[model samples]
Target: MQLKKALKSLVPPSLQARIRTWKAERAIAVFEAEWRESRRNAARIQVRRPIERILLVPPDPGTLMGALGDDAMVTSVVEMARARNPEVEIEVLTGRPVASEMAVAHGLKPVEIWESPHFVRDLDALLTKRRYDAVVALGADIMDAYHDFLGSAKMIAVVDLPARRGIPSSVLGFSFNARPNPRLAAHFAGVSPDVRFRLRDEISFERFGRFSPATSELVADSAFVLTPGAVADDLGAWIDAMHADGRKVIGINVHPMLFRDATDEQIATIVQRGADALLACAETARVAWLLLPHDYRGRLGDAVCLEPIRDRVAGILGDTVRHLDGRHRASTLKAVAGRLDGVVSGRMHLAIATLGMGVPALCATYQDKFEGLYRHFGLPDWLLLSPESFLVEGTFRDALARFIQQLPELTRIVGARREAVLALSRQNFTIFDDVAQTARIGSAGQGGSPAPVQDA
Candidate 1:
């Protein structure tokens, strides 16, 4: 380590960055080569049976900072599955000890297979030992190489391994960027044909269909079916008071993704601008504001990033503005969101929660995922704010004002499509039925009654 540090100190910072980039590219190339070769040599296992046991792989392995969105997906899937078959056994794979607690809290059996360096080997052992009838990989917009390429590769492997083993594996509803990483896309294209890839939107479906059309299907995000949990008493009362005063309560979620690649000074400036925009909207519309934090992942969490902006908004707006000071589960946050008249959110899942509750949301988008979400409501251009433009002076304030003004129209549109969206969201779990059918067809008279499948 000392020798490497000394060598790095001898090179220019610019040169070091170039070297890192080159190394990453080389690593991706190597992974792709190995992946293609493995696909070519993979032997298919045919052990068809009823869907009694399921292994759920969440996007995050669970850390000090957990992803509420991923939790929402996992919880939603588990609830829907149990509602269908009360006797189905579900095991959630956890990487960290804390993740086990999360799984247990949701009444799931936690399987620790991520502590080992040989992740695939450990996963294989767990599958063999546990004999999971199905593997459901929750691909919540992290299966691409845009960030965390190795993580993306691991997610792919989670589904690929089970599918190849004829254990009925599938990636749950997910989104893809406009231009995905070529190597990752290539690897996805080569995965077992039986492994299903469910894209959350038409845009992502179109993108993935380019190479993996046979396995890819269009579905909605699983979080859409998440049930709302109770909110804090004080927060609930505050919102009630605001409603009693005839004020429109609006929720806002500011995310750290907006500060990606930004300097400290730029981040501070952005926060100040965001605060200014919120203040303007609050005063202009006489609206009560709730500062919601969706992600709680340490420094990158929305709560930490929103602190400065929240402070600023509260300093002036005082009682009219409230920041969620504690970390809450996705369901509880959804409950809080459901009470609001409308929302302006940087996090997609928070927006999903609000929209799922028949409330309007103006999404400040950091990725290509939000467009399809808004499209689901039939208002494709329904006040979609770009993060770059949100930083511009007066832009966010104007957008927020416009969103508030058009709330009734947007709300009507959202309500009109709410049932359709829910249906699509529930379709995310139909992979269970698909696999169960395959089992029945592949092993007719196998001497066991298949687990009953239910509508989501």
Candidate 2:
């Protein structure tokens, strides 16, 4: 609309009107064609890297997978790695037990799941036991921990976290490559020397399933999963009200990462708010409750979708939601999102996955990323619990109502956002292609020298 308006300003009024009409139609066609070809090229680049033996370290289960998104990251990584090196071997190390089980279920060849306490020891054992050559740690885990624990791999890549913290120096220590956590990458530039910085924004999300069979199944089966268990004062009441309104609730059992390092009082405040939200939502509805703990004995009426995943991590839950097994985590979440009328929750990824799968989602967000994603898609009105507007009476419900009423608009906005995001993925793929080529050159250069194992 604006493009035509601008183009018409310089022409005669009668000619401008005609020009605007033609320009609008022509611009859309050109944009769409360019977008499609860009997506195809990006898909080729993501799988083009010959990642033959990769060890992926993922955030603990409850934490949102930044690089991985909703479908398991390890599964995507292994599949992409193998496609590059048909003989590629992939293994995953995760803090969350459920993540490990999900990785396997998602059909990542074979993996060894490790709790964080045992991360160092288990990593050493695996490194010694196999001929692993690469390591990929999701987001800031590479900066915070993995740099100290890397194996004798020739190359290591990290999905850069959002740059609000600072320029991540860790990427410089190895071959600095990045995924679309642009904020983190921006900060890292000021702090570290500019080496060959490879920005990998090209993400062929729609084509992800093509690279990994498990991802395809997960995408095909994804459903809405809601974790309304924020410690907000009215959570339980909200659940009860939703039930009264004829809503079918799916209980999500994951914990948030922001409060991971908070003080006890702060943590309690978040937990209580979560509990209130759950109680509100669960009371009026016969919610199909999915939990995380094996021993949770809560019976919110006759509706129970209990699928316990063993070796749980944190007990710092804000709300008292139930747990499902890791194996069923991906499928179950997908199933819930798919069947739901809609979702209103605090879980960021749950909402992200919901929108990605074409379901309308309302985020009761406590962080910038929540609003960031919605704003990224031009759906800022759908954000319920912005950091500035949380915990007020009826704020959550109003947001929920607004989202439900605007489902069609929300869906349209999400569709556009999906296309733009997928296009960004294609843009990033060009960088991945360059990096893969460079890595091969670096490997050849090193081949001139004897392969000597370096100690950390």
Poorly placed runs, candidate 2 (over 4 Å): 1-51, 60-71, 82-87, 93-135, 140-327, 381-384, 387-390, 425-456
Estimate TM-scores for all models. 0.84, 0.45
Per-residue CA lDDT of model 1 for 1-456, tens digit only, reads 999999989999999899999876665555444444444444444443445678888888764127778778988888877776778888988888888887787778888775445566667667666776778888888877677876787788787777766777778889988766665654564455567777887777777766443367677889999999998889889999999998999888876677576567666766877788887777668788888888877767777557888777776888988888877889998998888999888888999999999999988887677998877788757478877765678888888889888888888989999999999899878766554323322211121221211111
- Report the C-alpha lDDT of model 2 over 1-456, residue by residue, as the tens digit: 999888767678898688777765554344333322322322111222443455555543333232224343333344445546667655655445555566566455335434323333344345445544444543322322223322211112121111111111111111112232222221222211211222121122222212211100001101122221122234445445555755554443323333434454543343444445445554444343334221122332101212211112123222333333323333335444544456654555556556655666766444333543465466766455653233354554444445555666777877777655444323211222232322221110111111112111
What local distance difference test score does each model get? 0.75, 0.37
Clashing pairs in 1: none
TM-score of 1: 0.84
Best by the lDDT measure: 1
- Backbone collisions counted per model: 0, 53
